[model samples]
Target: MSERIKKELALYKLREIEIDDMKLKVEELKIGEQLGAMNYEEKVQSSMNCKNNDYVMNEIETLEKRIRFNEIANKRIDNALKRLDIDEAEIVRRVFIEKKSITLTAQELFKSRKSIKKSIDRAFEKLKLA
Candidate 1:
């Protein structure tokens, strides 16, 4: 692989790792939020004046951190794509980031699905060769 493409691939891989980390963090945040809700319900039911303010604050902080992490990761990917001069970031964003079907992406881009597939393949090949 060309050094340039290798570098881009490495950036892409790093971004993927960050994304996976964010996904896990999101799941954890969801669980924490659910627990916080349940705690609020319990406090209400008991009428003991138990305060879950701290719990709510902690969950909010965690959620904010996760959002920040995701934002940074996204920016990194954007910069990497730009550095590679792939000029196909939109295609990648639609097909991969948006999880759109190949056919849908092709229709949206006004290109044949086969052509889009071929382009994607060539991009990867070039990346590898770089």
Candidate 2:
């Protein structure tokens, strides 16, 4: 995968939270807290159907689309990580998921910095194909 995508893998956990938050917001809108979204008569009549309000429906659709995109990205990264060997996966998790510096990760793994860097490179290369 490209560097952009690899880096996005670092955000996988955050994306999970974001997707849930967005779904909650969409559910709220659907359940008719859409008071201000629909005008007077429309508000009274449309409480039964918020989709009558173009803006609210558009917002819900947008949120759903974003949730889908984040889910797909998370799945892609998860699949790639699963394809890695144990050592490579651990290195990727420490450096990317845990946001450790290479030196710190090397120290924790009890390896030299050069060995850690080489493993990272190899993992990324394999990830691209995965």
After superposing all C-alphas onto the true structure, candidate 1 shows an RMSD in angstroms of 8.6
Question: What lDDT, from 0 to 1, does candidate 1 have?
Answer: 0.62
- The alpha-carbon lDDT assigned to residue 107 of candidate 1 equals 90
Looking at model 1, which ten-residue stretch has the lowest summed lDDT? 46-55
Candidate 2 lDDT by residue in tens digits, 1-130: 5577567867987898999999999998888754455556775564554445766779899999999999998887778888888888898888887789999999998999999989989988887765
lDDT of 2 at 48: 52
Candidate 2: clashing pairs of residues: 1-128
Point out where model 1 deviates above 4 Å: 1-51, 84-87, 125-130
RMSD of each: 8.6, 4.4
RMSD of 2: 4.4
Against the true structure, whose TM-score is highest? 2
lDDT of 2 at 69: 98
